[model samples]
Target: MPADPESGQGPAAADPAQQQQQQQQQQQQQQHADGRPAADKPIKRYRRTELEEEEAKKKLLLLEEEGDEQYEEYVPRKKRREADEAVLMRLQGLAGPAAPEGDDDTGSEIDDEDEEQQQQQPASKAARPASVPQQRGKESLLVQTARAKKEAPPESATDKVLAEEADMMRHITQKQALRAAKELATDTVYTRSMSTGWKPPAEARGWSARKAQALREQFHISVAGDNVPPPLPSFALMKLPPPIASLLQQKGIKRPTPIQIQGIPAALAGRDIIGISFTGSGKTLVYSLPLICIAVQDEMMMPLEGGEGPLGLIVCPSRELANQTVEVITQYTDALKAGGFPELRVMLCIGGIDMRAQMDMLKRGVHIVVATPGRLKDLLTKRRMNLDICRYLALDEADRMVDLGFEEEMREILSFFKSQRQTLMFSATMPAKIKTFAESALVDPIEVNVGRAGAANLDVIQEVEYVKEEDKLAYLLDCLQKTAPPVLVFAENKRDVDAIHEALLLQGVDVVAVHGDRDQLERLEAIRDFKGGKADVLVASDVASKGLDFPGVQHVINYDMPEEIENYVHRIGRTGRSGKTGIATTFINSRQCSESILLDLKHLLKEAKQRVPQFLTALHDPLEEMEALAALSGIKGCAYCGGLGHRIADCPKLRSESKAQERSKKDYFGSGGFGGEM
Candidate 1:
């Protein structure tokens, strides 16, 4: 009843009698109290428009004739339809006698027909019903919808997209739909396909335990941390830019990854180290910093000693990866070139063009030489590429080096290295075989391993799709036809490899085929073609899974499921690399699969702790995720996000790639590492 302090006013325009009562209330606040200074009258603030709107709403509700009780109905008035003839009149006036009166209706009919046909066809895929007549308003919308629903491809946009949405929901797994979306809507298109069989040799049934042991030895890890590493030493103290340091800090990479931490220090100390880690781990930096450090050598420049071939020698397994590493190394080199290395020269000796040019470049005198095992071996044997002056020797991807059957070559290359030179062997896995190879190649060296490629990297999704045995080819065709981007199709035998390659070619699809049956030059050609984007698909055997790198491939299809699970690991490893987004689809059916295969498959899924996606069909029902997680127990960290998560969705770098001019993030598909036969 008293005027509020914030607003010294009572309700305005009250009745004269009420105004008198209000005056009494005001007087009470000044000691003529009637109820303890009259509960400080609650403030009432309202704008003129708001007050009028409330009043108008109340009046409308009060005037409602039909409503029984007082209720303000939320009446959103329907918009009036525009006159259809008005557009016709305007068009007729413009065109005069040239446009007939009914021309507009005919045009509308044609447009409706096109829309109906488009709606009927599934997204990204070509209209499969060659004979189905295009029906617009000929049938009831309900009837046509029902028929089209049944007729459309199961992997099409209709099934994946909710009808309620204005736009179709996308299935990243549908290649055809994604391509269509790209063309039709000018949106980034993503396509996917599923294949069941064509297993890699690592997952082959014929391989004996000795072979598994041999494969294991290819990447022999001597150092398994007795305890979790003392939270890695941070590189924050190195004083880098915010963006670069942010990634380093996020990974808790204060000092460096294990490989970088160990290898960098040893190489800086001018000692050799045999470093091993997973593919995504930072191995380039491990050897690079030390190389740069050695090159600078307290002289604030990449001092070039004329006639010195190179100060550092980097031998990689694949040309693509070698090229990629050179790019990263060069990026850092350029930054430090001003103060540390002004005229640092890096010579690349990898396959895909001319050896003469490479030799010419090498002879020009460079500070660093990045090369592949075979090309370097060839050059070394030819005495064109020399390491006599090279003090630091780094074997990037050592497992792939051995796996690609370059151990003998590596041994010979190492014999040329002086015992005083530092030798660093980096790989995904380090078994006894790698150790023996290293023992023969390297001297006493510090051992460092961040992790091995044991189970699937969480970001690299691994799943199995069961198709009927007869449907395998159709499934593969559907996958290739439906999935966009490049695919690496793995086949068990050379015959199936050729069959699929020929079939894809007949479909007017660009494909490259590689297998053991093919000669070295031919395989190299196939790989070169695929890497160049001249070939869209590659049908290959286990050899492709070795050190072969083609970074653009977004999908890996098992045309025939690899009987041995490790082969599956190697096959998919082709798609998902360096923390890029990739998918692996394995075709599993009754004929190809058995209890043991499913068990191994299930075991992998269990170890990954990922639920079997609904797209994946199998004889046995998938286990509960919590149970799998409990069984697997191990927490998998995303290489990109480091979130202890799985899949591309959770990977920060991958997510950024899709959103951030990422197509060139690093080809998941890369140039071939091995030579194919003619």
Candidate 2:
């Protein structure tokens, strides 16, 4: 109780009477004009107007009457009701009309009660009145609340909007389903009615193996399939359409070739076929006639519209083959059009040509498309063409396509087709890979082989000569002179073709050359001149080797022996066409020519009954000879590359190719590369 120097008047301030008097004085000082305690009031950051002050006073009185717990819950409930009312008003506006009378009576009553409470409150008290009357015949508020608790609540505006959206989506889905059903019906009807009216004859249906073998021997034709069709004797017996028959007659085709004998009927009967005959043996007609017939049938059934067509698709390996195929198809199509049949449209899609033109042709609707694999794949990738309606797919010169590394591209192109199609694979040889691909891609294909696959044309007199590497250019002219004008000289590479072409040109010979390096126009002109007799000698690489028809070509001179025996077969096949005998002269040497090819050539010459050179005869190995004998007996050889000289394990070409691939892989993806160490 002692007053220290740090405290002033501490003892007097501690007295109870003094403290009470000071508190009273302080309370009096804090009082406002309305006699409310200032300590209970909230601090105002900004001055309020008269209306805000009155509203504040009303809220304070309501809170005091209801207690803190009821005030907190009731105020939030009131706000929620107001917000829902605003949303309902917006939803009604979007719905384009007012709601029905009794649909929302509960909401309307609650809104009315709120409005009356706000209006009837006196300036002194903000508490709601307890005696507010309910609408006539309506349930009391407490009873309505109890009923709502027992039943599902009315749908909110958001829920109604979601329901309407779902209903609209269901209607759209139903419409789409109906449209799809109609399209499916149309497809079914079209498929049921479509037919080519071709059936196997009685003689073709059943025949003993001995009789079949004898017939095959007579015609030198080998066939393999279930229910193989017999060979037709004459063109008239084929029972082709009148126009086609007449056209064949006009073209002086009185009899069906060995390939056409069985291929045509099987194709017309809607069976997939693997046609393997020597080159220039009227193989084009086998696929062309069927393609035109199918296209004409499709056109007659329903005319093609824009962005719809190409019932037939022929994929070739090279541009020349594709163009040649298109020409063959066009000829028959023209014949059909002249004979009062539906006019068929044939398109040639190849590389080195403007794509816009091809696109325009597609826009106009084509009935048949003959295209090389590369260009065809490019168009398909760009979505400029589709195979939706195509029913006939012909892989012409399929061996050549596979050799040119187009097997993967062909598979990709096949994937573009959405449905089953009659696939025809025509080649001079059926390698094992091609056979496997055919088995996987085609459906029970008929294999029609005219004589042995990869056999040289017997009609052509094959003459092999040994010439030094330096002496080949000089000896080429003498070989060209063995036959009359219109001879084809083949080289293995473009450089040799150019060398031979230039030598012939400088020697005052009428010769033109073509290779992969030439432009499209140059190649076209070269072929035109050669075929039209404007040029006496046409020098070319293997580009002209496959599937090109040269009328009256009496001689084929190989400036250089091709690496592959299959190419050799195709090269000499340019002559001896259409049953006309011709001569083939091949130059060989120790260097720049593999012994395996020479062995294959010797076997081919011996098979064709042509004289073989002593060098080729001596170049053969005993193992190769054994394999060749087995190939002759079992018809099995290097089925991978169609080589008769070796099996797959001893294939020099495969070995070299594998080594090259390994080297390339090492170069690109060895250590410190993308693939890391191999």
Candidate 3:
């Protein structure tokens, strides 16, 4: 026989006609019944090989096994049963009333039947379309339950109790809020009404404005604000208590200084005041007398209980000043007690002292507290003391405090006061910035200025000398001989203070030194010895320049001119105290002192009617004409730093502070700092 073509064997399989016929038959079988040609159907372009298909089937089986294992591990039969029961109970609760007992039994029987059917089926049955309707029915039930819960009434006793408790807590919170608001409003109203309630004395009421102006002019006093009280003539005219008046007489203070003359009456009238006067002009007594009187009155009304007081707070800038203020107040307190008034206690709070001792004093109930800002803030922050009953607040050397970086602390302390209180700020020099600060901190304050603010004391004789740097030590002896014992020497730095102290000691002169580096006890001892007349000379840095009252100092020598004119004013003020005249000798070095400061010094000397040195007069200043114009316009000196040679924009202190702030920011933010890539 010939080659069999149907078997696709031998040479017949290679024939094109035979293959075409077979293809035609296969196409006919694949054609649609509507007579559409097979060519219209999509052709499969790629097909998996046998090995690829086998690998896919194996992957499918392995995935099925893994899914079964995970489902069994994640949801055991017992856990699934428990979860189903919990969900059913929740749905029933949301659906409203509980299900009947027979219905619960029927539901459990149905669940058991379904579980039995699932166990009899293969694992692949989980993916069958038969379960989709069951899942949809469960979702519809959940929706119905949520709708029912929204319409249901809250009738359970537990929910009613919780609602009542919530309402009670809300009511209590609202009550507390209202009480706090009422107290705040009362404080505000009282503070605002004080100015209207204040009145002048009978003698002061009758005086004409022209007469008052004449008195102020006669004493070189400057007053600002409305309803100012007239200046009393003497301590006796002040209407002080008999004990205080007698005490003043005993201390030989029959007459009040210009500051005391005006400040006392205003304070007695319960007016807040910003008292500006030269150093050694009885600024301390201005506040002290009022504080003592107020404290005494409080004590008489009701004796302080343990941890109950300080009725009055005096904030000083330095430890030495705080100690001195305590002494001054103690003297008046002792007099009050001797006169049969209630006993009052004064305590000192400062750094470098035992905090335990201060705490002990507080426990005993101190009526008056004289403190530095740092220590006082520490006590207040730690809750060791409180200002709840403190009604009188006085800031001595406020400008100095602000300069020493205590402005923030002062504001924080003010926040501790629970109610309106009397606030008084006294300083030798009140810069424009400090004046602005006082305006915000004090309420309707009266500004009592003894003279042009930052002006030198006229009672002191200022003598300026030019000395070569090398010959200063030898010429220091000549300046010392110009005055007697109890002289103060001020230097700009600690090293200079030590050098001068040693030189004086080697010369067999009784001298003591004080600087910031010295221990507190040593510094206090030095000051004590100088005040006691055991030391003829005291060499110190600018630490001694502010608010330190060294009585009977015949002379003050500036071993080095300070960088700022404010320091100079305070240094010279150490002398010329208590209506007594003294001498202030300053040595100027052309190389060490800046021309700006020298120009300021020259202007100050001219303003005080003192003789200006020839060198200072001959020195040419570019800002001289501008300064004159400013003075004519009633604007004098740098308002920021009290320098006559520059304005606030050009203030050195402000520039330095700004630079320091920027440096700190850079340090905190890393080398690239803020606004740069890390």
Candidate 4:
């Protein structure tokens, strides 16, 4: 009041020097009052400085307050009393739980972290005061359930007030959230029990090794009385005649694959065999070895077997596969020296090629005929060929052959095989229908489920990305360019396939579409190009998923998720095959999200660590527990192995022997063998 501070007259008048200082102070004050910071003071030029700082402080305070509130909210109340009661019971160690015996959490297999969350969740139901509950006639409710009769404290004079004032505030905790989620999961599963009748997989009966053994010795050999077949015979010892074995050796056939070893003997024995060999598991060798051996052996054994040529037959689902079969036969048999091994004759009859040429070949009395079901049916219908003389029949792609809608042709082909004929059906995937085909085609066949059939190979670096549908093509382009060399990109539709083909063509990215819409010749050519390494990337629909098997392919990209999970297995098998490692990348877009697929993917991950990508984290496990329970409800494992509870191979005895060898080696070395206390 004496003098305005900005004016500075009062403080400045005492001394000239003091007045000078005062004047400086007044000058700064005046500057600040003018809505500008003092010249000496730092200023915030950004407009949000004060407001943002204030808001930040406010938010911090509010968060602390909210946390307190959340703590208080955990107090058990009527609304959450039941949940609270359950938690209280669990906390008091009163769940009446047994020990972790055999992972028997069929009702509620909540994880450990989830159980803690449930134990911490607020009670939703609790006893109320007489004013609120007298109308319901309150029973004598125990005050503290955490204690026994001898230990429990009596109800306090004002226990309600103390309980209400229990140093807490209410807010949602992680435990509460987890418990709620667990509750939702349990509710979903409990409401819908997951029990269903077991129906063994189709073709399961025919593809078994035992059945094959039974078929072989029972029909082919004269073990009429008590002569039972021996345990799993070697592939080298399969049904092929001595001449055929000598021929295969000339072709450098060294070690036999499990399927080949197990399947060949059974097939040669004229057993109906459903062979569930994985891709590149030498399933072809199993069927082909038997076919050639039986054809030549039968031809040689029965001089009257000389109707025309080899009597064995092979039917593949696709021309590409049929072509491969024919090529393999040609290569395997090219070394034959004998009345030409009697197995020497090999022919190809598939769709799109000239019928007259096939007819001409058939007239030559070919012994081993590899044909697509459709084309073979055509030849049979037109009387261009007849299977009446065939002794061995093999359905190479029995499952896919059926899936491709060749039921009628398959039946017709089966009709030509007499009861004495040996039938073998092999598939990458064995759906139920394959079993039906086996029962019809096979006579007491054996079933086999190859290893990791539902799993993407561990050696394959499987990757997935979430992306928009519109940008998928661009992403694909980027991936192709980045991946380089060999990459297979799948497309959802034929239009998409064509578009990608054209786009890739523009970029000089070697790509070709292999789909049903394409002319049969084009499809075959596309697959051939991929196999021959003429095409770097194969862009196609489901056709490339199964039919085309290119062992040289280093990469497989799922530009679109396969319609079913089984297809995913087969598609990825195209890569990481023939004991060579490969990579597969599946792009997950919103469009392809479905409960069934999501659940399948989850189980796929849980069972097969070999297929788990190094980059996969908990975040990538996008399946919702509730959705999984809902999807898995009313489903049972296939009856053969109790619904695939364990891997089909990896015999315990063999594993023991391998372990014994490893242990012996360790003992000989006198060092810790495998980083363990051995």
Candidate 5:
């Protein structure tokens, strides 16, 4: 073995005798070949006192005497019985009392053992394992800390009531709920008890024991079904659960309306229905109840996988009506939810808003859909909604919906529903076309007519005045002065509505106008302002006639007669609702008093037991008068000025007016119909 240059004294130091001498010198110096002292090797410093070292030694010795290996034995040494008593006594001194005798002795012993071990260990032994007794002590301390806290007491009665009221307030918006609350609080006559001694007509009252005979002769409630349920005498007697009954009572609906009394039972029996009731006859609830009941019943079945399709579909003719129906359904849905029913989802689908938002809402499951025909069809076409699971369907204002060019849309929507559904058609007037549609649509429906089909409200004091077209605005202004507002005035067209609205506004009469031409937001605001009493009069076209239920309407003025005779019934229906009396004045002109209009008005008035005007009665037969007028005017004529002798091209009055306007323009411009002063 030769030493290399890199190893300075390696070969020489390998000698046994010489290596011994060098190691002894290295030990004396306590130095390595690198000149770093061996004594300076990393020595950790600890600040433990002498007493802690002695205690740790004693613990080790105790472990050895007990025949426990420190590495293998995980369990801690038990504390002496006297030491445990001393620890308990100390705890009692701090707590001011000893623990109850019923306390677990094992838990106390474990805790004492844990405390003694913790006190015995030195702080330097940071790598020591946690003992069973230490863990037990921690868990017990946690339990004691938890037991020290107390639960909050139940809310007081007053506080509970207030919280419930707050929840109710949050359930519906303040504006909407307050409006309905005001209407109910101020007007109790409409919903008063039926037991009040004020008897209805013998024909209207069907309380006799002759079951089948009474349904037909008395009350005029006709049903053509195998097993139709009889009309319930009151809301409380219906098959409604107790919660619904209480909710109805809370809303102050003690007695059922004639329509509700007749329609609810038939609908709940799962039979189709054709309910012809006036507006504000509580028709919304008549169909709403059965639909809700059906939905609740179906809820017991297995839920639909892709979320629930509409269980009930209510088709409204107009967006306003659709939204109103949604509001009514939402109120009841909230009541059902409060009564521990499943969260029933409801959605309103209409146009003139975000279609994407509506689609999103529909894509998420909805239990009920209150929709206008156009919007509903749009969603169906887009594949964003389905109605195959629908078991209940209601067509509100079916007549008007059919007439509003929505028949195709409505038919398409109806086709989407299953054949097993219960169909309900609610119309103010049942025209032949409506009857035909219902016959094909419903399955042996029960036809319930509250009054005559085309009859006006008997509570409405209707009057007719022969006012010319030019004088209609003034006559309406006078009527506004004579009657109590808020008044709803109907015109034939949007132009007429705008003209009347402008006139009223110029005269400083707070007024609003609503028509098909206005955007949906504008229409909604106009209605809100009118309903909130910010506007004294609402000037609108026939759009407001059909399904809108405007409470507190003191008068309805027909500024322009509706083209269809059935519309006259619906227009007058706006007032005199819910047994409250109102006035309806029709401003008729000679042109409006044509035989058909006059005859229909007379018939409607007479059917409603109102005094028909003699002038209207005296009008000649419309068909005969049309023939006579045609014979008198042999040539094509201008209907605007009633030019019987010539066409509008040859009419003297029209030509003269046009020539005068041209001459005035020429004179204002001096010569060339332009300002020629300079």
Candidate 6:
């Protein structure tokens, strides 16, 4: 009773008195509630060995279910509602405002009224009302979402800066004005000369051998001379003195052109050269370099006397050519002086200026004289100029000089020079007569022919039209409307030149006319205006064909076919110069196509690889047949009397025989005899 083994009981709870009281209370409670005293719960216990066996059994049956299941219920993935989904989508679409009848699947909502308006009207017409302030915005927004959208407008050319620049350009002075004009001219030449896609050589030394070879092949350069000099690899290889070479470099002449390549060396070596190249083939430099080199040498060797004549003489065919040559030589000589070389004096003795001034300049001692044949011959006759001491002679446009009937003057000028002087002849062509003249003029000359003799510039695209003489003005107007300035128009005579000039003026075209009839000042002014871009077109005769270098000429129009085939080559060469491409349009009448002209033109086109017109190709010149007939008949008809061997115009036998006949007649019919009366 002191303590129970498994129960936490104090000695007081085990007391006898307390037990007796508890039994009494329990008996009472039993009687009151008909309940017996609460019985003690029995304790259940297991051996430690049984507990271990139970844990072992549980471990052995580990796969047996433990408590509640944790995995999701097995249900097949919900089958796709194939047919029902379509109905659902349709229902969803129907739930929204019903789409218009012709509406596409685009999820846009359109007003019923706007839809009706769009359906009732054409598509191009806007559906919005004019009175609505937001009409354009609404339609543009709609169009932004539509299948087709209108293209945006192009940007305007007028900008704030452009307006200001234009205003500023209008206030420039004459010199500044010329500068602006020449800038455009230079820009045109630069743009055309260098292709947009071409890049400079990487090394910058000069054109590589591969590049130079490509140029030779492209330009079809043919070189034939004693020890035919290889094209100068660069200006450095020219073997020129540093001053001269640097001067050329400063002038923007980095390398030799095809003509200059072969021609310069031949002339420099003291060989008489017959340099044949197309116009603008850098022919000026062919003789110019030699002239300068010799001048420098002559000056360095001995100081000039006050009355000494020019050391070098260059004769051109026209005053314009002589002037142009003088200007170019002056530029180069100025460059030479800038490069530390002795000052070389160059003067122009061309006509249309003061002869007395030219005489005065000559007396003061000039190094080089560029003159036309007429003026030079006049000076020579008056003893104002001398070529007796001249060691260098050049005849620029030699063929043209001869063609212009300057043979006597040329012979006279050549005779005045020492027979031992070196000579150089540059011509666009070398015809039989020029060849004969060259034989007498030049000794042991090296021939440098670039391409074919008298060939058109390949850079010029030639087009021939069978136009009537009277309709040329109308046709030219049409062409001008399509082409850009500056245009050069060639006519056969001064009358036609003036007529075309007047017609162009009437049509409100800026134009100038130059011909033989124009005074020197007037002609110079016309050329100046044309070059300055003040005149869009220059109407001219054959006088503009040779030696004048007009910059940035984009087109050449031949309103009249040249009477001579050689002149044709020169006429078209006006446009395409210095590597710039141009177009040449020739107006020809079928009736005027002579056999010689037709043959020459066709051959030229074929050689240049240009397209030949159908009319020109189809034409059969009858003169060829006549020439064949004449050859077979051995007629060799004369130009004057239709006789053989001798032209009646220059036949001494005919003249003498006529004189003898006249004398006999007078003798026979003396004093009004019967023969005279009959």
Q: Which candidate is the best by TM-score?
A: 3
Whole-model Cα lDDT of every candidate shown, in order: 0.57, 0.74, 0.79, 0.57, 0.68, 0.68
- Candidate 6 lDDT tens digits, 1-678: 367746857765668798888898887887667454336434545433344556656654553455434533322111122234334445555222123454132234333434634664563234323332322333565767563434644433333323433343232111111011333345422111101121223443265656655655665666544433345546565567677777777767787887887677667667777888888788998898778877887788896877786988998988777877888888878877887778888888877877777767777789999988888888888877777788778989987776576766776675565435777888876643355456444555567778767667888999988898688889999888657899999998888899899999998999999998779988888888998989999999988889788868988999978756667888998877888888999998867655446655765787688888887677664434345433543423222122222222333323544566555564365666744533
- Winner by lDDT: 3
lDDT of 4 by residue, 10-53 (tens): 75564699768878888877768866664656743332223444
Report the C-alpha lDDT of model 2 over 1-678, residue by residue, as the tens digit.
Answer: 576646655766568798898898787877765676778877634222233456766887888887754553223333354465446545555322233354222323333444644664462132222332222345799998788877977776545544553453344233211112333345422222124677655665566767766877788787887866666666655667799888888898888888988788778888878888887789889988877877877788899999887788988888888888777777777888898998888888988888888888899899999998888889888988998988888888876776677767877787677666787888887665566556545566678888777878888888888899988887886777677899999988898888888888899999999999999989989998988899999999999998899978999998878888888899999999999998888888778887777767776777788777667766646545354345343545555566766555556666776676565564455465763344
Candidate 5: misplaced stretches above 4 Å?
1-209, 215-218, 300-307, 621-678
Query: Comparing candidate 1 with candidate 3, which one achieves the higher lDDT?
Result: 3
For model 6, the superposed segments whose C-alpha errors exceed 4 Å read: 1-231, 241-244, 621-678
Query: Which residue runs of candidate 1 sit more than 4 Å off their true CA positions?
Result: 1-235, 238-272, 296-302, 334-340, 351-353, 436-444, 468-470, 480-486, 493-498, 508-554, 563-565, 575-581, 589-602, 611-678
For 51-114, candidate 1 gives per-residue lDDT tens digits of 4557767767677755646665433211011133234334445321122345222323332334
lDDT of 3 by residue, 1-678 (tens): 688757877655777898899998787867766566767876533222333445656766787877744422233343355466456545555322232355222333333445654763464234333422222224587899998899998656434533553453344233211012334446544444133233456777899989988998888898888878888878766776688899988888878889998998888777889999999999998888877877776677788999988888999998888988888888888898899988888999999878998899899999999999999999999999998988888999988887788877877787788877788899988877667766666767899998878989999999999999999999899989987888999999999999999999999999999998999889999999999989999999988888999878989999889988899999999999998999999999999988878988988998899999899999886566454446443557565667776655456666776666665564456667683335
Query: Worst 10-residue stretch by lDDT in candidate 3?
Result: 172-181
Error of 3 at 589 (Å): 1.5
Candidate 1: 10-residue stretch with minimal lDDT = 76-85
Q: Candidate 1 at residue 669, lDDT?
A: 41
TM-score, cand. 2 vs. native: 0.68
Over 157-268, each residue of candidate 5 has an lDDT whose tens digit, in order, gives: 4455345434532332222111122233454222111111222334434555476456445555555555455666677567585678888888778888888877887777
Report the Cα lDDT for residue 587, model 1: 83
lDDT of 6: 0.68
